[model samples]
Target: MFGVLVVRLPEGRLGFLRAFSGMLAGRWDVEGYVPPLFDREARASLEPQGEATVKALFARAEAMRASPELLTLRAAHAEQSARHASEIVALRERHEVRRKQRHARRAELTEAASKSSTPEASAHAAELRDSLHALDQESRGDKAERRRLEATHASERSSLEPKLLRLERRLRALDRLRHMVSRAVMRRIHDTYVITNARGERRLLRSLYERAQPPSGAADCAAPKLLAYAQAHGLRPVALAEFWWGAPPPSGGRVTGAYYAACRDKCGPLLPFMLDGLFVARPRTFTPPSTTPGSLSILFEDRWLVVVAKPHGLLSVPGREASLSDSVLTRLKARYPDATGPLLVHRLDLDTSGLLVAALDARTHSALQRQFVHREVHKRYVAWVDGIVTGEQGRIDFPMRVDLDDRPRQIHDPIHGKPAVTEWRVIERRGDRTRVAFFPLTGRTHQLRVHAAHPLGLGAPIVGDRLYGRDGERLMLHAESLTLLHPGTGERVTFDSPVPF
Candidate 1:
């Protein structure tokens, strides 16, 4: 019987050979027997007599030689697998950390959105959304790059493969989170606008409703609360108390019962109630003194010109309608009825006491008008404001524009306004007030008054100015000085008025 004999070597190196022989035997249906090895020499001595069996053994030995190379390949494969697993674990850890950070940032943004109410809040939300979007795009790009890398390494056993998968999953999660956060921010902005708009509309409706109602008993229904709320929300209040009481009281005297008696007759019933509790009563309606030709001290005079001191409350010229009576021009015309062609060269506010120049003919009027129009004539005024001025006389170059809502009032406009330049110097500081001499380079309505009050922070307006000055009936302001060149003779003339303050 032909038999496959396997010799056992003393070392365990023959274990794989033994297993292979068993497998071959099973396949070929040969009866395989194991023979014990005595020594290396004895094994070699039987090699010639057992050549056929030996040759079969040598073939099996040659197959066994390939096992070491297979084992090395297996070892390399295991090491590559472990490296890939480690990379996957690391990527997963990074993904978890990034997710947590994103969540925290979203919470912070939500909290900030709650406290902001201005339009700026909406702008901020929009910016945040843009930033989140950019991050999402970056994450997507990274994912694509990671996938590309994974594909390149797909054929090789790399530990980084699983980690790349985890990284891609984390990036997708982050993109979703960014989208959600952006949506939430936009929603908050919309909600804020809706709430503010609704509240504003409701307030407007309520105001109209209240104004339409009939006046009832005085329950102190003053909208003080509403006024405060409106002011806080940048709204102007409309329910202002209408007082019939005239201008504020003079600084030296208190309002007596007699003053209210006269006010009641002149202003009707509301006057007494308005003036009763106040520190000062309305000014007594007094008849102005007759202009007895020589009563006003004429500073300069000629056939073509007349310069004289103008008393407070007397108009420079008559107005086109009522509330403008007993003006200086009216008195001058009356006094000089035969003096033909008498014309007003310039005008001053009724309460501005100053040296006013008038032209006696059209020729002089045209000349003076040209001077003023060309700004060739320099004008100056002395005013007393309610604060101590520390600096030496200075110039305020702020531009000005008319306040349209408060007609006749001028306000500083740095942009989109006419250029106004006023030069001022402190003449004297008395108590808490300073007397300032002003030179207005450009002719503007209420130029000096607005510049001093707003830009210079001068508290008091012109002393006797009822509209612009403090809440006293007295006009503290006086046009104390004037300067100009003679329209005909070209001589420089200066006049000074007694300070009214």
Candidate 2:
């Protein structure tokens, strides 16, 4: 029976065995023994020892057969392993090829990016080169131009020196002459002439005077005597016939004819004058009495002061005019007969309608005056302007000044005006219009209106202000809220007016 067993040899033993087998196979003795074993049989007859030898030989054959089969299996396994290795190599080659392709693609992408950026870089480089070239050209040109200008300037200076000296002397003399003439009567006469000429009346006077001038010495002699002789003889009428003739001719017969003939002959060329009568009309003047009652309704009154709603078109105080017949102060005085020293604590423009505070007594007046002057009294205004304000809240810190020539007109003058400030926030927007809350930091006249119109660029001019806004309308600035400390109670007092816009 053929049997096979798998056994694990020790590490060094397997190699040692393999070497021993090789050495044995190389020996002549082993080769000779192999031939004898194969001689079949130095005959089959050698006792039971022959049977044993047969069994041993059979066992050896089986062992040899098993080794060759194992060798075959090992060789097949090795061949499979080699095929697997080859397949692994091919896969690796494919992987390498894919990796290289990926690398190549990455390189291509990098190159594309570089190319894309190159134009911009090249453009920047070109600009820099042009700028540098321009600078070099400019530098070269500037040197020549500067030298030419310097030479020209030097020549001009040399040529102008003597003329400048002469001009300076003449200017000084002229200045002295001007100073002298400024105080002279001739200068006054010249000024009067300039004034008359500017009025266009001087030409009329010149024409009349030229016509009145007599012919040389004839005025001193026979001309006067002849004019007197003619007057006596009724050749020239004593009543001045020109005056009697009036406008359009009078219906008279031969008398008119004889009068015309005598005047034309004696005063020969003395034409019958057609007189246009001049009558000057005098302007009627009237002193208007302060009879108009104040429109402002007094809501609250105390011993120290009165609080009232100021009506539009009423002045806070009396103005220097007969037309400005009645004002708030005058009406208040008339209303409160017993009150002494009625003083205005603050004032709103004549067109502005809002809450106003008046001082009844001198002590309260001084106190309130101090508060306003020191900017301790807080004022709030509500205004409606044109256009949407971009920011929610903003402060205008521009300075303002009144135009001296145009009275009451305020202008934004940063360099030479008083510091004025206003803080404002938009409350609501209706279409293109915006309602804003204003807090004036400094109380300058027309402060809020100017700031809103000028720097803020909100188009809505204060409604009634014809100077700064639409004309033939009432100003729309409303004193919405006012806060101040009471002089008597030492408590804070507040007043508010409803927005009129």
What do the candidate models score in CA lDDT, each in turn? 0.53, 0.53
Model 2 error, position 442 (Å): 1.9
What's the C-alpha lDDT at position 71 in model 2? 50
Q: In the order shown, what is each candidate's alpha-carbon RMSD?
A: 44.9, 59.8
Estimated TM-score per prediction? 0.43, 0.43
For residues 120-190, write the lDDT of model 1, one tens digit per residue. 98798897787677667656765775576566557574544454455445545655554554444333322
Query: Which residue pairs come into collision in candidate 2?
Result: 464-474, 464-475
Clashes of 2: 2
Q: Write the per-residue lDDT of candidate 2 for residues 322-411, one digit (tens) a residue.
A: 677578888888887777665778887776668788888889988988888888889898877655777788888777787643456677
